[model samples]
Target: MRTRLMEAGLHDGATWRISPTPFLLTSADLSAIQSLGQHLLRFTHALNRLYYESVRGAQPTWVADYLDQGKPPDLIAYARMNRFRTALPGVIRPDLILTEDGFMISELDSVPGGIGLTGCMGQAYTDLGWPIIGGRDGMVAGFARMIRSLHESREGAHSPVASAEQRVPAPLPNPPQPSAARLAIVVSEESKDYRSEMLWLAARLREAGLPAQTVSPDDVIFTEEALFLAGSTPLTALYRFFELFDLKNIPKSELIMYAVKKGHLALTPPMKPWLEEKMAFALVHHPALEPFWTHELGADTFELLHRLMPKTWILDPRPVPPHAVIPGLTVDGHSVSDWKVLASLGQKGRRFVIKPSGFSELAWGSRGVSVGHDLPQTEWAAALEAALASFHQVPRILQEFRKGRHVAVSYHDPVTDEIVPMPGRVRLSPYYFIAGEVGTEGASAGPPSAKSVELAGILATVCPLDKKLIHGMTEAVMAPCTLA
Candidate 1:
């Protein structure tokens, strides 16, 4: 497995301890994880609506105020535009930490990495006769279906007979074959480390009968009406592999948005910056929004999300009244009224995490995360101070930290050339793909519909037991998940 991964060229110069065997999950666990996709999808749809309603006067204005804290006005307005109102992320990956009872969702990534890497691992494990959770080519197939759906829907929307509401589009006289549609996974300079994996993904898509390519932002060519590659290679759709925070650094970003706005280009994980914010999880827990979420997400999804999402508090510096305490947050059996009170908690009482909410370069890859128990008292205090200071520009969240249960995993030690058992904590990343269903000629009139969310694959990053963050590192064991 190590040799196969080394030869796969999907690592992009980073290295990890390769596991000799796949991570084992019980049948019940697999079913739960697979069932999570639709709930997450419905949650995402509700969150989008929440944001939009807040922008108008339907929902609380404070909700919009919280989401738009650090965002530029122009970008915020662009995200609220009607042309892209129905857009939702095509890919969703939640970082789930396995605990004693079950698992807790630590974070959700709309523009996540590891698709191609997971695909490679899936193929490698399948070749060894392991029954991988998703099929050997599941990732590739799922991505292809998503892009094809995007292209078909966009093509119909831009047709001469497209409706203003975009509920449905007129049938084309000659529809292009799904394989003939070209796709560009435009990687930004900030995301160059994962470019190789996306390139590998494009190759797999090509093999699955979809014309796809991975290119840098500089390689994109934008005319007044459409976007293309350097060689005038027209594209049918674009998978934005970059984050909105890095838009200023991205070349021709405005042009790309222009094309999308002009209905000349189709993009996934759409340009909704609000959807990329980690604060959505915090909002889901807000008591004032409970009725709103309950109405939009239904009782079951609302309850499930509440259970899965840990207690998260946005580190707002503004003071509450002396009588009022931060809802759902307490330390030492006391209702804390000020954020600074957290700075005084002892190590045992400080089992919390501070991380950037989103729209910042430090938000991803565990860059700006501070674990309360892992640091000294002084450092924890400083982390709290910094989070408060940056609340206006780059908001941060304080979340209850749940420790992962210890487990044993075997990895190949290149120096010893033997498999060795290593005890570690696991972080499971399950990739879910959302594809829309094209309406038939006589279908009822309404908004476009999507099929059930597909669980493409699950990648497990088992870090050494001592490590606080379970991410891709030299000491961590990276592998696919399979049935126990």
Candidate 2:
């Protein structure tokens, strides 16, 4: 397996600890995780609607204002257009921290990496006779299905729903043949690290008889009529691997957006900058938006999300009025009026996390993240002040930190050639694909399709116990989640 990963160039030039086996999950854990995808999909839909309604005066205007901050006016207007307003991300991956009781969703990634890496890991483990969560080729098949569904929807065809048992990797249904439609997974230079893995994925899709390929933004052939990888190979849909903030640097970004805006092509994730914000989590926990979320997500889902989502707040710099205090936030049983009070608290009192909200280079990959308890008093205060100061240009969010439960994992020591036990905390990233047809007119306001959210694969990153922030690093043990 180590040789296969290295040869495939899926490690992104970084070597990680090799686990002897897949991370095992209990049956109960499997049940709870399988149901989480649909709820998240619903949340995305509701968030889209809330923003549009806020713009139209049906809801609070501040909701839209908050999301529109720090974003370019032209791009915001393009996202709010009627042609693409019904669109949502075709793929969703939530960062879940495994606790003693359950898991908490730290954040969601729309244009997430690790899809190809996780798919390769799943196939490798399944080949070893492990009962992987999404079967042998679930990730590849799920991704193909999503692209095919988008293509079919654009061609005015109804997408066939898959059975619960058939959610795993399976043969594509034969109703609306999408063999002729090509898919281009466009990776920008900023995202060159995962380019090799995406190339591997495109090859697998081609092997499955789907016309898919990975290309850089420069390789895309743009004409007034449509987009193509070359003059002859016309693309039906595109999977954007780059973030919206980096569009200025990406080659032919305007051409690609023009193609989608003119109805010449379809793009997954819809280029909506607001949908990519981490502040959406903070919006979910807002008291003023409780009725909106509960109405859209229903009582049961609302309750479930409340339990699973950590309390979060957007670091707004404006001073609080003397007559009022921040909602749902208090220190020492007193409603706090200012943000600096928390910075002055001791380590035990400041169990929180500060990070960029979104639309910035530091938003992803744990780049500008600071854990309050892990830092000194002076450093924590600086982090808080900096976060508040950057509100207008690059927003930041403060979240209640929930520590992961300690677990024992065994890995093969390359030098010693012996199994070694390591104590660590786990972060599970389950890739969910929205495979159902996305309607153009009423899809955003309608209920979520039961079969749309398909759980393809789960990647577990077990960091050493000493590491407070869990991410893909050289010291972490990377493996796929599986049943015992």
Candidate 3:
């Protein structure tokens, strides 16, 4: 490796001078990751179905309203369109904290970061002849496959729905691929953290003779014929590199979705905000909805998910009856009637995490999280009060905190130019890439179609165990994971 390249490290824009060598996972670890992908794929399908069913009075009215709140009406309706009824995000990355027992998935992201970072690092390491997990081509191929599949799904023939009320997929004719359709990744200003990595990814794809590049939403120009970047490049498929919450800030962002709705463009993470929330995990643990989840996703899948997901409860600040207690929570050694009482929990009782529901800037990164045990009593109380206060607008959830076990890994010490050993907590974010036909034959089955969700790549962030919040290149060692 060149000295300049080593000095630059993984920075396209964000600088990460971590090890050039990747972290190695055990084969058993790999198997567990693959199993997680299969289960989550089925879980998301069932969750989506459950959401719509709840909207139709099969469940509760608050379900749909909670997910749809603060979303643009047109986009909500567009998301619910029969054309997108079966649509799932092609890329799924879950934040898995490695505890002594195993892994506890803390968060799931549809529009996740680390894709381009994972791609660039994996490709670089693969070029060095190392056996990287998910292979060197995993991220790139996964993304390209997603684009291609989304393009085909949108262009294919549609089956007429029995009624507007019924949201079943109506498959239409399969449109042939365009001879010269182009691909570009459009990033919004809010997601500049990964812009450079995406550009590097595009350059890599271009070297392999693919039409790929990264463009900002501001650079996109729409015409009666198609949506073009810089007025000359017609985009057949677009991978949205921005979050749904910040789309309004992008110049002419509305036009891109308009283009998608009019058949001039194909976009994904598919303008679906519901899938982007962290609160979906809490819904999976809802006892009242367990039957619906089991019916939509078979009992075995539900059981797996139940065991996988930690105990979580959506925090609603509505006052409880004097005789009633909040499920799974207590204060002062008794059932509590008020939400404010949660703020006074002592250090021993603060073994939980407070997270936002989503649709806000706070939803991304570590900004929206409050690690109870890590904070002082006053600070913890204050954070809990703030979260409770935001119940109506920005909902929050409390999840049982799972402590990550310390693991030893070596990192590149740029100062000494040496590889040194360090013990840190691991956050395993495995990128499960969905390809081929994503339409699951039976979401209620035990596992999803294994071929649909493939193990694209794994990103391991090993941060100092002392650090409560893990993210970015700060003191953390970021690397592509391998089962070598």
In angstroms, give how far residue 193 of model 3 lies from its true place: 1.7
Weakest 10 consecutive residues, lDDT, candidate 3? 438-447
Q: lDDT of candidate 1 vs native? A: 0.83
Residue-level lDDT of model 3, residues 101-170, one tens digit each, is: 7788888888888887788778778888888887877777666655555554444422243342232223
- Candidate 2 stretches with Cα past 4 Å from truth are 12-14, 157-178, 439-446
For each of the candidates, give the backbone clash count: 0, 0, 8
Model 2: weakest 10-residue lDDT segment is: 438-447
Candidate maximizing lDDT:
2
Identify the superior model by TM-score, candidate 2 or candidate 3.
2
Q: Show pairs that collide, candidate 3.
A: 157-171, 157-172, 157-173, 158-171, 158-172, 159-170, 159-171, 298-444
RMSD, each candidate, Å? Answer: 3.7, 3.9, 4.9
Residues 340-430 of candidate 1 have per-residue lDDT tens digits of 8889789999999999999999999889999999999999999999999999999999999999999899887778788899999999999
Name model 1 segments beyond 4 Å from true. 12-14, 162-178, 437-449
Query: Over the stretch 188-240, how does candidate 2's per-residue lDDT look in tens digits?
Result: 99999999999999988887768888999999998898788775577888889
Error of 1 at 435 (Å): 0.6
The true-structure Cα RMSD of candidate 1 reads: 3.7
Q: Which pairs of residues clash in candidate 1, taking residues 3 or more apart in a chain or in different chains?
A: none
Cα misplacement distance, residue 343 of candidate 3 (Å): 1.4
**How do all the candidates rank in terms of TM-score, highest first?**
2, 1, 3
